[model samples]
Target: VKTTVSVIKADIGSFPGHSRTHPKILEVAARRLKEVEGSILIDSYVTHCGDDLELIMTHTKGEDNEEIHKLAWDIFMECAGLAKEMKLYGAGQDLLGDAFSGNVKGMGPGVAEMEFEERGSDPILIFMADKTEPGAWNYFLYKIFADPFSTSGLVIDPSLHDGFTFEVHDVIEKRKILFNTPEESYSLLAYIGAPSRYVIKYVWKRDGTIGASTSTQRLNLMAGRYVGKDDPVMVIRAQSGFPAVGEVIDPFRTPILVAGWMRGSHHGPFMPVGVADANCTAFDGPPRVICLGFQVCNGKLIGPADMFDDPAFNRVRDQCCDLSSVLRAHGPFEPHRLSLEEMEYTTLPGVEKQFKDRWEDLPE
Candidate 1:
């Protein structure tokens, strides 16, 4: 039997200034999802990453199922109302549309979906990040799937030696292209390297099996303005032909600088934190990523093992904190501050436009 895993998430509301989700909001969502538990959805799990509420569900309805999408849309709308009742900060923040049309894409919220035949032992990982844009996963995806250095499976595992194909999306232009790994990796890197523009939409093994996939819609781009960070969600299938569970997670051991810090204007290290600690407190960030692992058996999600809960990741968290401090010291400088192109959605562009004519052009 085929099962479709749909992970649709959004920051419908946040408390204490986008730091975390309110309990009442989550409770409302849980109740709504439970209402459709057995009939509409085969199984479901509701969780949060920072302030964004994640509704992970499994169904036989296939990808972009209208019924499933509307179910999630309705739940978020109800939760947004509850948040407003409680005066939650950034209430109804990620719901970019007043009404749900056909689907949730282009209406805000991050969505990663996949449909496949259930294997005997299916180990899947769900990665949800806060305070960062969708493109933040570009680097990690490349390293995990393409780089033999990060994923030893590329060198050792015969199944993965065949390499993978990556689907890259130009989020700004709404264009997409595919590149085969080991052969066209440099071509893929040339685009994804400029993560602010290009993002990895999904990946597949050479034989067409899904390797990994990410939610690629940027809320800012869709809104044509800054609503909030596009905080992304991803789903990766591990073991068998793909990388092992450990190989899939090893890229996060060293903090990598990603766009997003205070006010969504700075570059800071992306820290892998436990799901329980997935709060965006300091500078609204030092962008954080939380991972949950599950074993799917007969369309049921089991053991949402907090992947980063291990003590081994503690040192990396400390290192990220240290890096955050150093980067914060730079303040308004480049390499710390995102480039002017990336700052288009921020207030900097408008502020710079005001002084555009007042400033004199230098003559060399």
Candidate 2:
């Protein structure tokens, strides 16, 4: 059966500050999805990564289906209302518009979805991140799909030898391009290396089977202001012709630096953590990512095993802490803080305006 897996997320509200999601918000989302589970959805799971509430659902409806989008929007609206009653921080912050349109793409929430025929024993991984942007997934996706060293299957396994194709999006230009890997891998890097602009939206196998999909919505760009980080989500189908679960997740062990930390302006290590530890605390985050493994059978989601909740990842967590300290020490300096061009959507422009009059031309 052709099943569509949709992972939609938004920061409707959180407790105290933008550190963690309120339990009540999650409860409301769960109850709301349950109401239409058997009718509209085949399966549903509601969870959170830091302040963002993620709704993972399976259905027969294809990508960007109006009914699926509306269901998610209505749930977020109800949750936002409850959040306001509880006086939660940033309540309804991501619901950019007053009313739900036919879709939620530009409305504020981050959506990553794909529809595919279910393979026998189809294993998939859902990655939800908080305190980061859609570009944050670029590094790992490259390593998983292109780099042979990162994924030995690319070199060893015959099924993966032919390589994959990446569907990259230029978020600023609102354009997309495809590059077949192992061949145009160099060309692909030239764009995706600059994550803030070019993001890998989807990856497909040589046979045209879908390998992965990521939410490429840039919230600041959509709202035309510094609302918050995009806090993206991704779905990667594992095993069979795709990379094994281990190969797909192995890249994150390095703890690479990504934009969106405190004030959504600083660069910090992207730390992998379990759902239980997926909250922003230090410096509003060293931006956290959580992976949940699932098996899709007959359009139903089963076994969301917390992939990163292992002792093996403890060393990387420590490395992230160390890196965070080093970066934070920079304190508003470049390489730690984003460049002026990237901060255009942020409040940096306003700060520059304040000092505009006092500034004089420096030594020519």
Candidate 3:
């Protein structure tokens, strides 16, 4: 058996406050996917992460197929139109590039796909994130594949004792050169810790087994302009030879901080929340992530175990809620405000323009 899972996401609209998407808009997207089912998908699901709408599709069309990508794009565009009708906020917001071109790669959305030979039992996890860049997965990936404390498989399971290798990418570079983890763990960590410029593209076990993969592509890098915020998406294959679901999910439980929110301009903890949860409070977010569990067979989707609903996660959410309140109180001050580096890609340019004269006299 073979399985192909494609996870693509776009920000069609957000409420007037730029916090959530209109329910009707999501329904329109569902309707469009239903219309294209026979032509494009085997089994599909639609859901939101913050203000973005994500289309989780199972198909044999392979990655980046125009017929498939366009189907999702058209649905989002239609949803965007509906958002406009309701006068929703940020309608058609993240559709940065003028044309969709061959695919949405750098146009504004985040895309991650995996095609592999199916196991006796197939399991995959879909991750949708709001308020963070592709690099948010840095720590999670490191924990799942590198740390034995988190992934006991390394110490207890012989099949996983050998650490995994990661292909790290320098997203800022035009030419993509990848460096590996384990052997180059320190070097990889040094680069990925920067987050904004480096991202984890894929990971494979020491014995050559693929552990995970993510679409490290960033839109602002390609567009040369910050059209809108980057709402990233991810997919990870769990169990069997890879890390167990527990390991993959362990890192998120900590809701450790990352950069993103209200225009992709700040750092905050990546809260793990359930389906239907709204965006962050105050200046937009403490950043959030949603996980969907699934099993695939013969190139189709099976289960999406809305992981956040489990009783164990309930405690984590409580912690997140408390953290949000504390952080919100800080408002625009240090530690709460996005660091100056992360602010560069956002509206800070406009702020910079206001003080452009400050540098005039010191320069030629």
Candidate 3's residue-wise lDDT over 288-321, tens digit each?
A: 8888988877766777788876677777777877
Top model number, TM-score: 2
Of candidates 2 and 1, the better by lDDT: 2
TM-score between candidate 1 and the true structure: 0.97
Per-residue lDDT tens digits for candidate 1, residues 12-114, read 8888998999877778787887888789888888889888999999988988999999999988888988888888988898898988897998888789999
Residue pairs with clashing backbones, model 3: none
What is candidate 2's local distance difference test score? 0.94
Candidate 3 at 174: error in angstroms?
A: 3.3
Model 2, clash count? 0
- Candidate 1: residue 256 lDDT (0-100): 88
Instruction: List where candidate 1 sits over 4 angstroms from the true fold.
Output: 360-364
- Compose the digit string of candidate 2's lDDT tens values, residues 201-225: 9999988899999999998998999
* Stretches > 4 Å off in candidate 2: 362-364
Residue-pair clashes per prediction, in order, are: 0, 0, 0
Q: What TM-score would candidate 3 get against the native? A: 0.91
